[model samples]
Target: MTGTVTCEPGTPGVPGTVGTSGTPGAPGTPVVRRNRRATRPAPAGVDPRPSQHALTSRASEDRPEGWGDASASKQVSSYDAELQRDKPPHWG
Candidate 1:
C-alpha cells in the first residue's frame, strides 16, 4: 500500500527538495534590476522630519497657528482620506 506525508506550513523549504547554494541569477541566468537606492548616514545638526502618523495627527487637528478648535476654522476636508471628527463643515 502507498502512503502520503505532509510538512508544516512554516517549513523552511520544500518538504522533499534539497537546498541549493549560490548567488541569485547565476552566470547562466538573467541579471535582476530594481529601482531602489542604497541607504546612507545623514549629517549632524539637522533633525529628522516627523513620521506619517505624527504629521497626519497634527494635520487632522483643528488647531491653527493663531486659531482655536471652536473658532470655526477648517480642519480637514470631506475629500481627504481621513475626515476631522466633530468639526464644522467649513473646517475641512
Candidate 2:
C-alpha cells in the first residue's frame, strides 16, 4: 500500500505514514517546527539603531552640495583626458 502525508500551515509537527508498530515512519521524512523566540519588548531604556534609509539620508545631508554628481563627472572627464594624453601626437 502507498500513502501520502500532508501538513497544514502554522502547524508544527511531522507528517508521515504510520508504521505497523504504531509509530511514525522513517526519520528521513521532513518535519516542521516552531520558532521559539521571545517576542517581548526591549529592556527599559535601550534604543534601536536608525534604519538604513534614515542613515543613508543622514549621510547624504552631511556631504557637500552637488558632491555626487560632480564626482561622477570628474571621473569621466579625467578618464577621457588621460586617454587623450596617452595617444600618439599623430593620432590626435
Candidate 3:
C-alpha cells in the first residue's frame, strides 16, 4: 500500500471548553452547593433585617442630613468629626 498513515479520530473536548459565552464548567445543568455558615441572634429589640415595611421608615436613615436629593452622589468631608481621639506622643 502507498505511504499513507491515518491515526484514530481525536477525542472531543468538554462542552464549555471553547468560545466566549455560555455557562462555566462542562456546559450542562448548574449545581448549587450548600452554605455551611450558621446564623446567630443579634442584640435585643433590634431587628437587624426587618421583614415588614413599617420597620424602617426610610432606607436612607443612615445617610448624613445634607446628603439627600442630587447631593447624594457628592463626596462628603466632615470638618467637625469627634470620633478621632488624640494619639499619645511617641513617634514624634
Steric clash pairs (candidate 3): none
Cα lDDT tens digits, model 2, 1-92, are: 13544333333444444432334453334333446667876676854443433433445645554464444335457777797789998896
Instruction: Look at candidate 3 and tell me the lDDT of residue 5.
Output: 26
Summarize candidate 3's per-residue lDDT along 1-92 as a digit string, tens digits: 23322222231443333322343332343323446579988799987777653643545755565364335565544532321234345634
Q: Which candidate leads the pack in TM-score?
A: 3
RMSD for each of the candidates: 16.0, 12.1, 18.1
Candidate 2: where is the Cα deviation over 4 Å?
1-29, 43-49, 56-92
Clashes found in each candidate (C-alpha, N, C closer than 3 A) = 3, 0, 0
> Which scores greater on lDDT, model 1 or model 2?
2
Which segments of model 1 are wrong by more than 4 Å?
1-28, 34-39, 52-92
TM-score comparison, 1 vs 3, better candidate: 3
lDDT of 2 at 59: 52
User: Which regions of candidate 3 are displaced past 4 Å?
Assistant: 1-36, 53-56, 60-92
Per-candidate TM-score against the hidden true structure:
0.19, 0.21, 0.22
Ten contiguous residues with the weakest lDDT in model 3:
2-11
